[model samples]
Target: MQAMENGGDLPRRIGVYTVERELGAGGMGTVYLARSRGGRAVAVKVARPELAADPHFRARFRAEVEAARRVGGFHTAPVVDADPDAQAPWLATAYIPGPTLAELIERQGTMNKEQLRSLGAALAEALQAVHACGLVHRDLKPGNIIMADDGPRVLDFGIARAVESTRLTATGAAFGTPGYLAPEQAQGDEVGAAADVFALGAVLVAAAGGSAFGTGTPMGLMYRSVHEPADLSALPGELRSLVASCLSKDPAGRPTPETLLGSLGPDPNPSPDPKTLALATADRPHVAPPVPVEPPADHGRVDEPLRRAPAELSRTPRVMILLIAAAAVASALVGGFLALTRHGDDNKGGGPSVTASDSRRATSQASTPPSTPASSRVAAAPKDRVTVVVTAKSGRSWISAKDHNGQILFDGVLDNGETKNFTDKSQITLVLGDASLLQLVVNGKEVPNDFQPGQVERLTYDRSGEMY
Candidate 1:
């Protein structure tokens, strides 16, 4: 299942939707819980930066978005709006407010035979509509299935096609989740509608409390999918054969969605209400929701200064010092000697003070600090250690930080005027959903970047305060 991180940097608005909070993040992009100006709740998915930058991906995304809009069925979240030409291409769909199938399984254990039949029939019907539109949902797993009040609702359909040939998949990495991907996808073969049926079988296996190919590494899972048989021991005898047919090694051997729908028959028992299921599945003791707090009066003002550490020097003076030192050293080094001096007057009147309005321009011009020899830089701090401070300034932004071991340090939204400090003994990797919303300090120095508003930023830092 894609790990669900809560409360991410909420963009004030995406298109006509007012973003309220983050729902989750996936291979495609971050999904936000947003509302239209008319107050209709919607789930908006913005494409990852790498995907948006590719013309090939954009074309496919535009086409798939159009096709997805045409897909209409009771068992699928309907596409509501899209903007593939935007700086970050995005697609919005009717929001399904319920725990995902994966979350439900985790909370309540595997489903019974009646529930399984209902789920299978609904998903197959959803896939039929998707295929009718000439689109295939490349990724179909429990996480993408929402257990709505009425029934199961498939999500993220048609969007996966855009990711197929992108740089992310250019390295021969498969496009879908490991265990749930079809055998053809595992082997890097051209996939068709049959792939979704294969994934559906795997999802059923999971719902039955077993792995289709058993649990292991991504490579192992794919290997098993391609070369080994699926273990359907957990399924009931009546359902096993149907699921087995869907897991066939050959694409032609699998049942089509229409065939599966016909065979699954009617559900004898309806699923419990989604609200009841959610209450039953609580992972932790319930806590009251935090009280709402008023946003700072200066919210969204670009001129607001980032929360700075007391010991850190002002960015303007530090930059000027480095530029002056570099110029002096360049001229004096010819004599085999170098001398540098700084006067207090340089800070007061030697140049115009950098105001908040000029912050972006000034920082852009002097972002890179003068490089020093490794002996001078690395000797002062432990090479393995790093520290980063992120402060939301102009707006709110979602930020995620991970360590060298792939442990998440923080994953959530940083509200306007909020500050978070993270330190690690090894490398620290950071992802910012809206780069313009925040300022970063690495180690003890301000780390200037030339990130545009709404541009996704990924940065890795080490003890020397250098970004990789």
Candidate 2:
């Protein structure tokens, strides 16, 4: 299960989705609740920056995403998008609309015999689909199961092997939750489909009652899984036999998901109502994080004035000082008279006379050109500047952007996490080499577009206009 964390610093855009916030992070990477360009909500799982550097890890992660994509079953969260070769490889899946089984059990207590039966059947069916795709859901603990409206749905199938093979076992230790790992997995043996069945059995025990092996240190749990018999006394009378068969020490003795479904008979409950499930799974009330306090601005360092005091005033004799003051006064009077004459001539006809304007222009050209006025400089600065942040997630993509006036702002290759922010007035248009490789953000909102891999796209957006 991914550990929940405050997602305060999570990027506003990842891939093509706008990240709402982080849901959690495990040994693998952070999971974010994000929305697609088409307004579809999805759970985006991103690999950690460090892990993305490992070539072996990237290969395994890509394989996991591909394998998960091939599995077709209503019982699993379907992969909506993915880019494993990205700087921070990520996968997006349809957001399940319910709480995890673990959360459900924690809040409402264990499921009754009937609920357990339904859950067992659904998960087994999901496993069948996974195995058929030549993959194994290495991590199938209660946390990975969501009790959706229709039934239980499995999640996090993408990159399961990457997490198991790289992050968790980096210290030469085994991966997976100790209590839920199959005996074969704990023994460091190569796993097969039956390994998932063993995990399902453990899940059943928790659903029917609680952890069968109880709690202990990692080593203790590993010891019990390999040597001790599971304490299954709390399991309901009817499910004990089937659950035990699944928890058998030998993998061959375990029942496949299909066989387990048959053993459970039939689904007894109608699909849960979507509205009810949504309400039940609504985010729990949480204390809003305290607003950060900003440091006070420094006001002591003032800019030096451009003009300097006349040094001659301090050193000149008293007589010379009076002479200098008189001379300065005379010069100011003459300058003011000249300014009045120019202004009167300029306003003779309620507008500047052509001769006056020409004379002013000639004077201006005769001296060094006046510095650009602050007002004019501000106008010259970009306006309606739509900041477009483009990040490359996979292979290199040709990225070019233009302002509403058709002026190109950016033209270059972008690859995995490589980002460029552009500013323009009115609107911005983007031309992408491959839709899937580029994630777009204009101003602060994510641009919605489902550009297929290797497909070129030309999209335009404005401050007030929707992306097109």
Candidate 3:
């Protein structure tokens, strides 16, 4: 049911539970922290009044309760209470004390190999539970996973209408985060386990420290999910194909969540005691496996911020390359953002391309560029930050321009198949293939982007419509 008021907090005690605090709000409702009569902490979700009046929504919620009830996994937050018939129907589940995975990724850019492997394993395990029960967690995204001390826990089942439910979903009703949604879901195909896997693929990109779908706003990502090839350029080699398997558009081509876990190595970060972690963080903490990351043992890896650079700068496949060569010779500050990861800057700038090592070097080295000479500062305010984007498909990298914020200054590919940077704040978004997300790099550090561009490099895909 919808909250009685728009943008207003929900009322306490819908029936027997008491609302404690507002957790979050959505277009249809607000999620709250509440307590049941048994003194258990519960996450109570109340719908907006408008939605409550819709019989279709009510039927969906009623069936959702049953579908969610079938879920059984250590990685899932168990549902404990509900009142599908209340005037403002609501469902309550045990309160999961932790920040969402989305929160953790924003705080810490991509996870090193070990962390990615750990995440893949845990999430795969969680999905296995969901799949086994014959229930699909239609909504799976970074924001949906809670990083508890134990492991990543999946949440939110309100939008999940059981397949067996006789009630039809409201016309044009679509659920789940845009970038993370599968292609089939976008096309309004009846979904099942595969849809969730596609979402898992996007989630992994985010977990590994890349944008969910390159760049652009949430809406842009949704558009990309529907029509473009995925940008998995930042993905580590061992796991890239694994993620690809999950993203397969053909439902039969994708792996069951359980099968997905089989591809990842064992978990290195042992789950900690939730009680102890809760005591330490005070507030609900969304825990990560720990950072200053180390890659998995199979791969020769070292500290993340201090590791040796990859052999080549990561690149999008194709004849399209960014004018990195031209940019390097023209300006001292080629990339954007701050935080040096390497020693003295590479003034020569003539580095090898296509290798991950070089990309690492660029990130590490440019990250530590020496102070800018006072003479050249004024002429290039817009070019103050350089952005680099890598993509899964092939493409000729290009450059455009954007203002200080994320507004588009220009849009086109500047170069093809090479490493480069820009100083202009005309925020450059690397468009990989015909995708919605523009692989974005602000001043160098990987950052999320809206559709508004600075400048952008075009990505070319060897193949397209990659999902299956």
Candidate 4:
């Protein structure tokens, strides 16, 4: 149901709920924050226009919604209402305000060991509940898990399948995110509970550190999932073996959700106190503000003249003094900015590092040049600062460029013909989508690129123009 508004397009109502605002949108549809007639807050996911017109998709959606309703409320958000037959089908669930796991990690960084364990255990339990209802959550990833004040809540079973279904599955379709998809899923094989477990393993790795398979094109990630072992080197020693088991290439070898739950052991971070829990439940927080980037501190040079240099010095050659002062100020600003952008500082030496000890191993990689080739290396310049420029040539691409300090210099889509520049003193990491569509220039030298469209690529560079 759509209620007309006075001006531009606005959906005042959807079914019985009054639309408040859009929470988010995805391939399937947009989810709106709405209030029921009874004054209860809810999240209403309205199907996309095209999806609503597809009878097959509507049937699947309706079945999934019914299954979602059957999911136990213990570790999952319960479906409150839905209307699949409506003009634009929609489903509503109790609104819980919190950041999704993906959002949390992006803003607050990776979770501690105990936090990761809690997350894994909670998700496994949720899957157990979901599976007990004879449903397999075919799509389980960080974006689908909400870190509520009470505990983690699993969400979005939009593509869940009933265990007893005999219809041919659409395994070949690129339905889920690449890195998180199971090997079987990537191969277009029948996905079962083990598939969810595989996704769980990927999620745990992402929560604890970063993507286990690393970033690449979806097809590349899929190939890795089918052929290579998960990289759990970043996981704590205590969890390596267990997480490894969950990521086993063979479905039969993977642990069931119930077994995985037991393996998580005791909660490392216990629940809040009764009073705290009461308060949390009584008045829930709606959203968590993104972590703020620390702005560069003022060097106080902007007012240095007022503090130092006596008034009598003002009689000196004004132009000469001004030129000298300006040069000094410029040099100081550039150096400070470079130092602040160094990535390894705030990490306190915790992340992957390209140290002297690993230089031999790094150089041994045949595909990646340990150092810029003599033919490709940038000519020696006056300053040692590293510089990078990316120009989108034929197609739009997504980009995330970060300095050593983990500060995002740019993170968004880049349209064709657009260009972006970045600089850093120590190192910079770039995550690029459709790498083939962009030309890369490092320190004024162009690097050879044969990347293809729709592929993801991650590149790290140091001040010396060395690739890591």
What are the C-alpha RMSDs, in order, of all predicted structures? 22.2, 30.1, 17.1, 18.6
Give the runs in model 4 whose Cα sits over 4 Å from its true position: 3-10, 158-174, 267-468
Over 1-468, each residue of candidate 1 has an lDDT whose tens digit, in order, gives 122255445577788888888999887888999999899999999988888888988998899988999999899999999999988899999999999999999999998778888789999999999999989999999989999999999999988778765645222222677778775554334578888999999999899888887664443455346534677777766688889889876676689999998888784444466676667666645744334343332111111112322112123221222222234544332111111111111111122223331232211011122232212332344446786777777655655566665444554445555555666787777656556678787776666756655454456787778865
Worst 10 residues of 4 by lDDT: 334-343
- Location of the lowest summed lDDT over 10 successive residues in candidate 1: 334-343
- 312: Cα error in model 3, Å: 27
Residue runs of model 1 more than 4 Å from their true location after superposition: 1-8, 169-174, 267-468
Compare the candidates by lDDT and give the number of the best one. 1
Indicate the TM-score of model 4. Answer: 0.56
Q: What is the lDDT of residue 367 in candidate 1?
A: 17
Worst 10 residues of 2 by lDDT: 335-344
What is each predicted model's overall lDDT from 0 to 1? 0.68, 0.61, 0.53, 0.64
- Top-down lDDT ranking: 1, 4, 2, 3
What local lDDT does model 1 show for residue 378? Answer: 27
> How many residue pairs clash per model?
2, 1, 70, 4
* Candidate 4, 190-268: lDDT as tens digits: 4677778989999998988656676655534654454356777667666777888888766766788889878786865
